[model samples]
Target: MSSNIQIHDIVITEQLSDRSYRNRNADLEKQAFQQLAKQSSYGAQAILNALCDLTLSLCDADSSGVSLLQVVDGEDGFTWNAMAGSMASYVGGRAPRHHSPCGYCLERGAAQLYSYPERFFEWMRLVGKPIVEGMVIPLYGKDKNAIGTIWMISHRDGHQFDRYDLQIISIFANHASAALRMQELY
Candidate 1:
C-alpha cells in the first residue's frame, strides 16, 4: 500500500437540542410527582419516608433531609422533632434547634440557598465538618406558620442548584408542610 493518508470532511448536526432535552426532563419530573401524589399515607412514619423520597427525587439532590421545629408550650424555644436524611450517616443524631442555617431559615420564614461553600463555615465551625452546597426550604402549615424545613445537599462535584431546582423543591416543601400538619393533627 502507498504511504499516504486520506482525510474526510465531517459535518455535525444538532438533532436533540437543549430545549427538547429540557422538555423531556420536565415531562419525566411531572410524571414522578404525579406518582408520588398518589401514594397513600398509611402511617406517620410511612408518610415521612414518602415525603423525603419524593422531595429528594424531585430536587435531583444527592441527599435530602427534613428538620422539624415545634413550639413547645411554656418553653422559650422550639423543639426539633426528627432530623432525618437520605444518607443515614449524615443524620447520626438530632440536630440542634438553634444557631444553624436551617434554624435561621425557620426564624426568617423563607427559603434560602447556600451556593458558596463558605456560607456553611459557621456550621462547620460548630461540628468540625464541611458541606459543599445546600438549599433549605421552610415548611409551613395550613396556618402558614413556619414549622419545619427541608434541606438538601448536593453530591460532590454535582452542578449547583438553580432557580428551576428551587421552584420544584418549593412545591415539594408545600406538600411536605401539609403532610407534617396532618401528622400533627391526627
Candidate 2:
C-alpha cells in the first residue's frame, strides 16, 4: 500500500523476458520431492522444516521459511513456524497480519515478488539483513481457505529469481498446503 512497497504479481506460467536462472532442473526437483516424501512420515513440523531447508538450497536464497496465520490476544498476525538459512534464528518470530508481504500475497491469492521490503515494512530492518528480493506464495487449507505462506528471500543486491525458481516454489507451496491440511486433521 505504501510507496516503499515495490511488489508485482508473478504469473507462474509466464517466463520473464529477462531471466535470472536458466531453467528448472528436473533431477533436482525430483530429488527434492523424494526428500520431502521421505520426511513426510516424521510429521508436519518436520516436513515444514525440511521444506525451508529445501527452498533455501533449491533457490539459492539467503533465507526461506513458512509463515502461518495466527491470532495472539485477538490480534491477527503470522508466526514464523519454520525457517532456514541466514534467518534461521527467527523461527519463532511474529509479524503483523496485514502489513507484511506474505499477508498481502494471501489477500491477493497469488504469488508475489517483492524487492527491498524492509524499505517499506520498516520493522523488517530489525532482521539486520536487507531483503534484496522476497518471493511469497500463499498456502491454503483443505477447505480452500488461506492458511499461511511459504517464501524465499535473497539478501544479495542484484539476485533475480526467475520462472524456474517460481516453478519450483509453486510445487513446494502445494506440498506445504497439503501438509498443513494434514496437520489440521490430526
Candidate 3:
C-alpha cells in the first residue's frame, strides 16, 4: 500500500493598530459615582475639581485639569476650570476654540494622549509652562454635544500614557459629562 501527502499554501497577514483603552475597576467606579453624586449637589465646577484631583491620582500623571467651553469678548475658547498637580499653574489659562487640544478631543469625541500640545495652541500657556505629556477626554453637555474636555498632563520626560491611563481617564470623563449636564440645568 502506498500513502500520498498533500501540501497546501498558507497565507498570513499582519496588521498594526492603536491599542483600545478599556479598564473597569468596580471599586473605583463605585467610589467615583458616590463622589460625583455629592459634588453634583454643589455644582459642575466642584465636580470638575473632584474629577481633576481624581484624574491626577488615577492616571498617575504629573497633572490633571478640566477645560470648559467659553465665550470671551465674542471669541470662542476653552478655559481651565479645575487644575491639579504640576499643571495647576495654569488654572485660569485660555486657549483658542479651534486648533487646541481640547477642541481636537471634542471634535473626535475620544480620549487621547499627546506631548507638548501647547506648541500648536495660540492661547495656551496663559499662566503655566508648556505641557510635556497630556491626556484629554471630551466632555459632553446636556445636549449630548461636546462642550469641552478634561485632561491629564505630565511634565516629566519619561512618563508616557498607556491604554490603562486612557481607560481610567475615560471613566472620569463620563462622570464629568453628567455633572456638566447637571450644571447646564442650573
Candidate 4:
C-alpha cells in the first residue's frame, strides 16, 4: 500500500430523491441503446468506450469513464478502462481501490455523488482537472459482486446533478455490468 494514501470515510452517497425521474428523453435513451448495441460487436473495450462517450453526451458531463477493479503492482486497484471528454487522456490510469470514490460507491452499493473529490482523493489531483461534482454508479459482474464503477464528472463548480442524471447513469451502469460480464466470459 502507498504510504501517502489517506482514507477519508466521507459518505458521499446521499439518499437521492426516490421520485420517478421525469426529465428522461426517450429518443436519447433509444439512441444510446442503439449505439451500445452497435459497439458490442467490436468487443468489450469498444462497448466501454462507447459507453463513456454516451455518458458524456447524455449527462452533459465534462468527463466520463469506467473504472474496473483489478490487481495492479501486486495490489488491488481500479484501472480507468475507457474515458471521454476532458479526462480521456487518463484512460489507462490506475488508483488504489480502497482510497477512491469508486470503492465508496461499491461499498454503498448505490450511486454516489461527490463534491470536490480531489479533496479526499489525492490522486485525483494528478489528473489536473478539478472535479466539482461527480456521480458514480456501481457495476457488478456475473456473480453479482461489484466489479467496478461508471463515473461522470462536472468540472464546472456549482454544476449539480439531479435525479434525471442519476437515472441516466444508472441505466448506463446496467449496460456496463452486462458488458463486463460478457468480457469475463471471453
Candidate 5:
C-alpha cells in the first residue's frame, strides 16, 4: 500500500471514540507494523517519520519528537533523531543523559507526563525554551531495556495532556521502540 493510503486509513480510524477507537487504533497500528517490517532502510526511515507525524496528529498536540539514548564512552545521552510539528528549534539537538527530561524517563524506564512548569524547568532553562504540557515515554529495545524516549509537546493554548493522552502515547512509544531497534539493526 502507498504511504498516502496508509495515512488516510490512520486518519479515518482515529476519528472514532471509546472502544471503537481502541479497536481501530490497534488495527491501524498493526498495519503500520506490517508495513515497517517489509521496508528497506530508506523506507524504514520514511515510516518512522510518518509514525511520528501520526503520533502528533493522534495526540492533537503541536509538536512531537523522538530521542535515542546512547552510552558514550562512559557517559550517557540522547540524541533527537526524528521529529514533527512546530518545535523545530529543539529537534536535532543533543542532551546529557543526566540532565534532560527525556533522560529522566529513560532512567526511570517509564512514561512521564510533564504538564506543569516545575516538572520541566531545567529543560526549559537549559534550552531557553518555553515550558508547555508534554510527555515522555521510554522506548525499549527488543530486550526490554530502555533505549530512548518518544515525546510530544502541546502548545501553550492547547489542552493539557490527560490520562487518556498518556495511555495513547504509551502505545505509540511501544511502536517507536521497535522502530528504533529496527533502525539500529538494519
Candidate 6:
C-alpha cells in the first residue's frame, strides 16, 4: 500500500440512470454501432485502439480501456492491454484477478456499472488518478471463452453512465472479440 493513497469510506454515484435509459439515446446508439462497423478494415491493435476511442466517446467517459487476462508463472491477473484518455498512463500495467473490477466483470459474464471502483480494489487508488465510475463488459475469444473486459470510466463528477452506454460499449467489445480471434497482429 502506498502512503500517498487515501480511502474516503464513501461512494459517489450521481448520473446512474434506470436500465431503460436505452430508449432515450436511440439515435446515438445506432450511430455508435455504425461507426464501429466502419472500423473493421483495421488490424487487431488498430481495432482495439479504435474500440477504446469509441468507448470514450460513446460512453461519454473520461477514460476507456481493455484489460486482457494474462497468466505469468501460473499467477493469474489482468493487463491493461489497451487504453485511451485519462488513465492511459497505466497502459500495460497489471492488476490482481481476485480484487480487480475487470476481473469481477469477467467473472460475472455480464456488463456492470461500478460506482467508486477504487473501494473494490484499493490499488486502483494507487494509480495516477482514480475513476469515480466504471462500466465494464466482458470480451470473448474464438472459443466463446471470456478472455478479458472492455471498460469505460469517468473521472469527472456528474458524468455517470447508464444501460444504453453499456450496450454501446458491448457493441465495440463484440467487434474487438471477433476481430482479435480472426487476426493476430502480434
Give the best candidate by TM-score: 2
Model 2: weakest 10-residue lDDT segment is 6-15
- List where candidate 6 sits over 4 angstroms from the true fold: 1-39, 184-186
After superposing candidate 1 on the true structure, give the runs of residues whose Cα lies further than 4 Å from its correct spot.
1-26, 70-86, 90-92, 116-130, 184-186
Worst 10 residues of 3 by lDDT: 7-16
Estimate, for each residue in 1-186, the C-alpha lDDT of model 1 and write its tens digit: 112311111100121122122222667667756654655366444554566676566656666666666445543333333333446354423444564556656766777666433343333334333445567788776668776677776655644555666667787667656665676742
What is the TM-score of candidate 5?
0.69
How well is each residue in 1-186 modelled by candidate 4, as lDDT tens digits? 234433343344453564345577999899999999889888899988998999888888999999989987799999899999999988899978887899888887888887777777777888887888888888888778888889999999766677888888788788767866776741
Ten-residue segment with the worst summed lDDT in candidate 1?
A: 7-16
Ranking by lDDT: 2, 4, 6, 3, 5, 1
Q: Write the per-residue lDDT of candidate 6 for residues 4-83, one digit (tens) a residue.
A: 53322322223345444745466766776666666767666677787888887777788888888899779899888889
Q: Which stretches of candidate 5 lie over 4 Å from their true place?
A: 1-44, 71-75, 117-120, 126-129, 183-186
**TM-scores of all models?**
0.67, 0.89, 0.77, 0.88, 0.69, 0.81
Cα lDDT listed for each candidate = 0.55, 0.82, 0.70, 0.82, 0.62, 0.75
Model with the higher TM-score, candidate 1 or 6: 6
Model 4 lDDT-worst window of ten: 1-10
> What clash pairs does model 3 have?
none
> What's the CA RMSD of model 4 in angstroms?
3.3
Clashes of each: 0, 0, 0, 0, 0, 0
* lDDT of residue 53 for candidate 4: 94
- Scored against the true structure, residue 40 in model 2 reaches a CA lDDT of 79
At residue 102, what lDDT does model 6 achieve? 76
What lDDT, from 0 to 1, does candidate 4 have?
A: 0.82
Please give the lDDT score at residue 72 for candidate 3: 85
